[model samples]
Target: MLHLGLGSFHRAHQAVYLHRLIASGDERWVLAGGNLRPDMADTLTALAGQGGRYTLETVTPDGTRDYEWITSIRHVLPYEPSLAGLIDVGADPRTRIISFTVTEGGYYLDGRNRLDLSNAELASDLDGRTQQTVYGGVAAILRERMRRDAGPVSLLNCDNLRHNGERFRAGLLEFLERRDEPGLLDWVAAHTTCPNGMVDRITPRPSPDVAERVRLVTGRHDAVPVMGESFIQWVIEDDFCAGRPAWETVGVQMVASVQPYEEAKIRILNGTHSCIAWAGTLAGCHFIHEGLSVPAIRRMAMDYVTDDVIPCLHSPESPSPIDLAAYRDTVLARFGNAAIRDTNQRVAMDGYSKIPGFIAPTVRERLAAGQPIAGVARLPALFLAFLQRWHRDELPYAYQDQGMDPAAARAICASADPVAALCADPVLWHELAGDARLTAAVRGAFDEVHTTFAGALHG
Candidate 1:
């Protein structure tokens, strides 16, 4: 397998799973990983120096800390402008699976589910000038594999996006069509399979203390150590074209349909996560645990799930088999793990993407059913408040949003009716962007957020 986006989450989740399989005497699959961009150069260098080995630190909510050496990654290909190493490995027939963990916004799809050409990277990739985007990188690899007649491969998507594999395949196909590569597109349609998969692990960016702790526990000075919560889950659709690992043996759920799992996680877990991050930042809390510590913020998350998402996802007429209530509690408990210390900044960075992907679906569902959206309303309301702080440069930390257009966001913030301006953003709300019901609900919730959390806001 060749994996892209060698980030901390991939290290903690996917790589850890593969390590378990390899440790269990199934060494048929080994990961050769690299990044499309030059992210984590220092860590990649450290990992390569250690022969593609690194330590993983996991902490349970009850304060149980553990460390293990992960050696599933056999090759850490160095990043070059041309992506020669990645293409070579991906084009190899033996490399049956190619997985990636690019974040939600990285797909560059607009509300209409079409390729967003406004993004400079996608534009360049379409022009065949660079392979910086996921579509570009994967396309280049597939084109080479076709040229070399390297047989079929599975394109696995390990991200939080709903129907991730299907969505990514659509984006890739659209990209190929625009590039006028009919032959390459035909080859990909015949030879590649994109399997949707859900990945979960609360991996925080490694702090310096993690390295120190790793050295203390493992008696090794490991530089590229990763830290994550003890809780982990992965549910994948069993539709690999070429072949796949026996991930089921390692507690991975290989299901025929990943829809139920993806919807549950994306809404219950991911949506609540964003709520806490935004509300926590507003309440002057630094970590997710700290946000959960605040009764008001915690209540908002609970109510959002109980009042909106659960009802929308699982109803009386057609009930879901999964124990959604238990799942909700488990997600909240995982978020409340103080030892994990998941930062509000990291969770709060991608609000522009989260609003549509995580929050808006509930809003859309509830509104369609003529139900009150008060609970789900709080999320967007909190985001509006957070964005105001960002606009005023009052946030304690920097905000990062891949999907946000700086000029457009600034104009919205500067507008006389900022709430209305925000509610009208098609990128964030899609067809419901300027809906009066959405604007009204968000406006009311905005007021409530200020009044209800007055003390926290001031703090």
Candidate 2:
């Protein structure tokens, strides 16, 4: 397998799973990992120096810490400006699976599920200016694979986006279509499969202390160490065109449909995570555990799930088999793990994407059912408050949003009626953008942010 985006999450989650499999003496599959962009250069250098070996640090909520040396990534390809290494590996017939972790916002799909050609990166890729985007790099690889008569490959999506596999395939096909690669499109359709998969593991960015802790526990001066929460889950659809590893043996759920699990995780876990980040930031909290420590911020997350998301997901007519209440509690408990020390900025950076992907669906569902959106309404309100801080340049750390247009966001924040302006954003709200109920509900919630949480804001 050739995996793209060799970040900490991959190190902690997928790589760990593969390591377990390899450790069991099933060495049929080994990952050759690299990134499309030049990121984590220092970590990559350290990992390559150690022959693709790294230590994984996992901490349970109860503060039980464990360290394990992961050697699943047998090959760490060096970053080349032309992506020669990645393309060569991906075009190889031995590489049956090509997986990636480009984050939820990286797909660059519009609300209508089409490629957003307006994005400069996508435009450049379509015009053959560059091959850095996922679509561009994958297209180049597929074209070469077709030329090489590589038997087949599976394009696995390991991200938080709903229907990730299907969506990515759509974006990739559209990208090829726009680039006028008819033969490539036909080859992709015949030779590859994009399987949707859900990945979960609260892997935080490695702080400096993480390396020190790893050295203390493992008696090795490992420089490319990664850390994550003890809790981990992966649910994938069983639709690989090419053969895949026996991931099911390692506790990976190989199901016919990943819809139920992905929906549950996206709303119950991801949505609540954003709420905690936004509300926590407003409350002057630095870390996720600190935010969960605040009763008010915690309540906001709980109520949103309890009132809006749960009903939409686990309706009386079509109930979910998973014990949602237990799942919700487990999610909150995971967030409350102080040892993880997940920062608010990391969770809070991508509200522009999270608003539509995570929060707005619940709002839309409740409003369509003639139900009150008061619970889910607070999430957008919280984001608006958070956006105001960014607009005023008051945030302590840099905010990174791949989907946000800075000028548009600034205009909305500077508008006389910021709440109304936010409610009317088509990118965030889609068809319900200008709905009066949405506007009014968000207005009430925004006012509540000032009135109910005035002390936090002022403090």
Candidate 3:
């Protein structure tokens, strides 16, 4: 199999599953890692250096640990000038599925729910010179496969975005259309399969300390040993352009449709994470699992989910997709795992683009149903206020790197007034403000957070 964006998530989630499959003696599928980002060079080199073997440490519930050795990937491929070979491989009948873990921003869409043609990075990518965007490169590869009459292949997206595979298809098609790639678009629409998927695993970032600790534990040096929660879940659509592995054996639920699972995950797991991360960071807390360890903060989180979020779920009739009691317990346990010191900043980054798309939809649903998002409503509003402060250079802590530049954030937030500025951008504020109740709740909550946080800092 060909895996795009071979980052920590892929190694911790998909690779582990594939490793289990390989241990059970399935050898047809092996990952070929590719990246358009130069930053991945070190990580790619480290894995390639290790001979595609790494330790997977499962942070257990009772504070115990279990380790497993994974060898699911066989090779790594650098993003070369010409992606012809990559296309040829995907087109080859032997390849069954090609997966991706490209983050939410990688898709680059504007507020209009249309492809962002104006994206400077995206424009640069289509020039066919530098590998800039994932969509452009993916389109180039897909087009080549069509030209060569490459057989069917399923494209699976493991990202947190809603209808991720569909978004990938749209993004690729948009690129193809803008470039006028001829019948390639039609062929992709008709032949290629884009399977919507839901993947959940708490794979925390590995720092030098983590790497050192892992080495001490395993008695072997690992440059990128992945730290994650013991719990893992994967829900996938049964549709595949080429065939698929018996992933069911490895805890993959092959469903007739993945829409419900996607919605459930987005609204529950991802949405909650975004909320906690954004709000927690502003409140001087870092790391999601850490948020659960504190009583007041954990209470806020629980209230946000149960009192505010649960009422707004898709099917009030159906049982909640996640085991609420178990999830709360697991979250607290995961946070307490000192091995997985998942930074709050890591979760809090890119809030300008991440929050609305991930959690606002659920917040909107709750509002539409005339439900009071008492605990949940404040999250987005507070996030916006936090974004405002972040942009305005008013944050308590210092952020030196480029991930979420307070300066840029300030510029965006300061571009216009709060309600007007946010409401103007559909991507940021439309849904949340559409409901009169939510608008007021968010506005009031934003003010409350500002007041509360300000008092905590100054008083």
Cα lDDT tens digits, model 3, 1-459, are 888777888989999898998788877677777675667878878888888788877777565777777888887766556655556666666766878787777778765556776566777876655555778666766766777777777888888878877778877877778778668888878878888898988887766765676678778888868767788999988889788888998789998878766765666666667666766666677666666565655666677767766666535576655566566556555555655667777776666566566667666677677777668766776577666656656665554322233444455476644644554445565444454666677667666667656743321
After superposing candidate 3 on the true structure, give the runs of residues whose Cα lies further than 4 Å from its correct spot.
81-85, 127-129, 314-329, 394-420, 431-436, 455-459
**Clash pairs (backbone) in predicted model 3:** 287-344, 289-335, 391-409, 391-410
Superposed by TM-score, candidate 3 places the C-alpha of residue 221 at a distance from the truth, in angstroms, of 2.3
Q: Model 2, range 1-459, lDDT digits (tens) per residue?
A: 999988999999999999999988899999998988887677778899999999999999999999999999999988877889999999999999999987767899888999887899888888998888899888888899999999789999888999999999999999988889899999999999998899999999999899999888778999889999999999999999999999999989999999999989999999999999988888888999999998888888889999999999887899997889899999999999999999999999778889999988899899989999888999999999888888888887899999999999999999999999999999999899989999999999998887756875531
- Give one clash count per candidate, in the order shown: 0, 0, 4
lDDT of 2 at 200: 98
Q: Please give the lDDT score for candidate 2.
A: 0.91
Task: Write down the TM-score for model 3.
Answer: 0.89
CA lDDT, every prediction? 0.92, 0.91, 0.70
- C-alpha displacement of 359 in model 1, angstroms? 0.9
lDDT of 1 at 282: 90
Candidate 1's C-alpha runs over 4 A off are 455-459
Each prediction's TM-score versus the true structure: 0.98, 0.99, 0.89
**Candidate with maximal lDDT:** 1
